[model samples]
Target chain A: MIAALLESFAAAARGLPLTLAIWGAGVATGLALGFVIGAVRFFAPAALSWPLAAVVEAVRGVPFLVQCFLLYFGGPFIGIDLTPIVAGWVALSVYGAAYFSEVFRAGFMAVPPGHLEAARMLGIPRNQAVLRIMLPMMALAVLPSLANLAVILIKETAILSIITVPELTFRVQGVGSATFAFAETTLVLALVYWALVEATAVASRHAERRIARALAA
Target chain B: MSAPILSVRALERRVGDVEILRRIDLDVMPGEAIGVIGPSGSGKSSLLRCIAGLDEVSGGAVMVEGRQTRPGDGAVGMVFQQFNLWPHLTARENVALALKLVRRMPAADAAAKADAALARVGLGALGGRKPAALSGGQQQRVAIARTLAMEPRVLLFDEPTAALDPELTTEVLDVIRDLAAAGTTMLVVSHEMGFIARLSTRVVFLDHGVVVQAAPPAALFGAQAEPRVRSFLQTYLDRVAWARDA
Candidate 1:
């Protein structure tokens, strides 16, 4: 029993790097994409904002599993082909982008249009005003939500195993089946995810403290 | 005689079906403070906003220093009623960051200039505090410092004291009064008639989206004022008196 448990644990641990890679890629790309969409909605005309809004809505309203399957399995219909790993990253990014955009939209809105107008009225360049005044405030407001999304993406990576991405869940499930150490494998899987999430929380908390100190009145 | 430093010709503003301002024309010579006064819904703020490019100009032009200018032409600066300082940054940072970003000043130069601007506004010691830590009056001064550091050719003040109480109003008004005395070349829209009568080089009265009168303080507030202007002033003064007594 002890040997089987150790074997399953090692197998699950082996998938850690791949899991982190997918999660990090999805989050980084999603955050960048989300920021663009959120800002477009805030600064652009209704015509542009409306279409982006629709895309965000559809991505958010649909299940992540369905999105992953449709993109991976249905890609050939549109002359698109991606490896399972790439497909999982893309789906996770889409899912994250949609959710993170909503958080960002609220953050940007909270900064007030007056700040931009004040900057403009003072002859401050538009980009400088946004980069300096608007973005910093928006970043502070959205940090907690963004961190939450980062952790959610970590768990979302486990779903990638369903697409045969050979991530933690896939490897651990294989070990459980072959060695009949289902209970031990499940415990190891849970512990790994817990650790990743706790680490994310700690990092986020640290950043919040740093920023809070800087912003202190 | 010097040509007008700022000119607004046939300015017409329409918001949906309503005409907020109609065919308004005016000019401000250098070293002059033009006070804009009117009843609520009388397009007083709209005129300032139109010049600042905060509001789209439906018709007409705003010419500053012989050039057609919009916002950020490095010609116009406006102090808002709300004192719209970025809440997260220190007062000094608020002033310095704009200088760095817009003027391309180096960090040391920006910080030095920011301190000087703050000192000019009597807020030198409060420079390290954020807007939230400052009083409404101090925040407004910090905002003025931020605008002043930019050194625009024209300043448009949109009821700068409208958001403050009587005591706080006095603190901010003193700073602006000094600015006017120093010949900053600006237009001020305000309800503080006493301050307007005292500080303005000329006063423009707007009614029904039109310039009812634009005259020196002595004329606009004098018995010889236009009938509409006279009646409006009488009513406003009477209301102020009533509020004070009540």
Candidate 2:
């Protein structure tokens, strides 16, 4: 069992690049879309904000796995010939974007009314005020939340294995099926994921401490 | 006589269902410092907000230097009650941000101007520090520096030292007095009777969103005061005196 666990760990390590690629692509796309959605929600009129809110609510209510499966298996019927990897990336990006938008919106709301008033009284244009004064403050406020989202995105990459994307989880499953060593392979995969989460948590803690010190100064 | 730097005529404002300010008429001449005094929630801050073009006036106009403030035109600078310095920006950067973003001043020139403004507010050495690094009085000075860098024709201050300790309050008030001495056209909303007494050329007393009296600070606080004004001043003076003692 020890030997089987070591072999499974090696297989998973071989798929690290694929795992990282999915996570990277998904986060990049999600962040872009999230900024747009968050801005629209913040500045749009009630008529617009309500519909956007409904869309965000609907997306958040659904399970991510179901969304991935629907996109990967159902795309062919719509005449969009997406490979399983492409489908998984697109699904995860869309799902993650919805969650990220809410996070950004909350950060934007945290900015005080007085800051904006000060900018206006200085004769700063509204758009310029938002770019210079508001965005930087929002970025600092949202950094911790973004770091947590990064960890979630990394773990969610494991779900892409359901679409046969040949990631860490997929390699673990393949090794288990080949050698009939389910317990060892699954345990090793769990350990790998635990290690990844632990590393992410440590990085986030360091980032928060840095931010706190900066704020204190 | 020279034209007033800021003029407001019959300004009316309503927030949701409640009227916040009503029939507010004011004219501030160049180089004059006007003190606005009232009880809490008497709409002094709201009136200042309207004059600074930070709030919409439901039924009046604010004119600065003969140009009426519209949605796009920039005219006035304001210092808030809470010292709204951009937390992420250093003192110099916070002041420079307005010059760069609004006036489109050259980066070096804006930085120089920001430094000068900070120096004027007695915060020359603290220019590199962020608001979180500064004490409350220091932050208020930075806020004043930011407004001064804008070089607006009219400067509006909303309860500038309301949130500071007495010692810190004196620091902020000193900067404001210096601005007045330099002939900046200022409208200050404050509860500090001493500041109003020493700095104001004229004092406007407001109550329930209306001006009850407009006179020289001495006259308003003297035996010539209206009955309501005298009653209000008595309560205000007593409270401030007690606060100082405590």
Give the candidate number with the greatest DockQ. 2
Model 2: what is its DockQ?
0.58
The docking category that best describes candidate 1 is medium
For candidate 1, write residues B144-233 as lDDT tens digits.
999999998888889999999999999999999999899899899999999999999999999989999999999899976999998889
For residues A100-206, could you state the per-residue lDDT of candidate 1 as single tens digits? 99999999888888898888776677887888888888878888898888887898888888889999888988998888888888888898899999998899789
**Model 2 steric clash total:** 0
Pairs of residues at least 3 apart in sequence or in different chains that clash in candidate 2: none
What is the alpha-carbon lDDT for the whole of candidate 2? 0.86
- Could you tell me how far off, in angstroms, the CA of residue B176 lies in candidate 2 after the best superposition? 1.0
What's the true lDDT of residue B95 in model 2? 89
Q: Give each candidate's interface RMSD in Å.
A: 1.5, 2.7
Per-residue CA lDDT of model 2 for A96-172, tens digit only, reads 88999998999889999888877777777889889887887888888788778978888888888998989999999
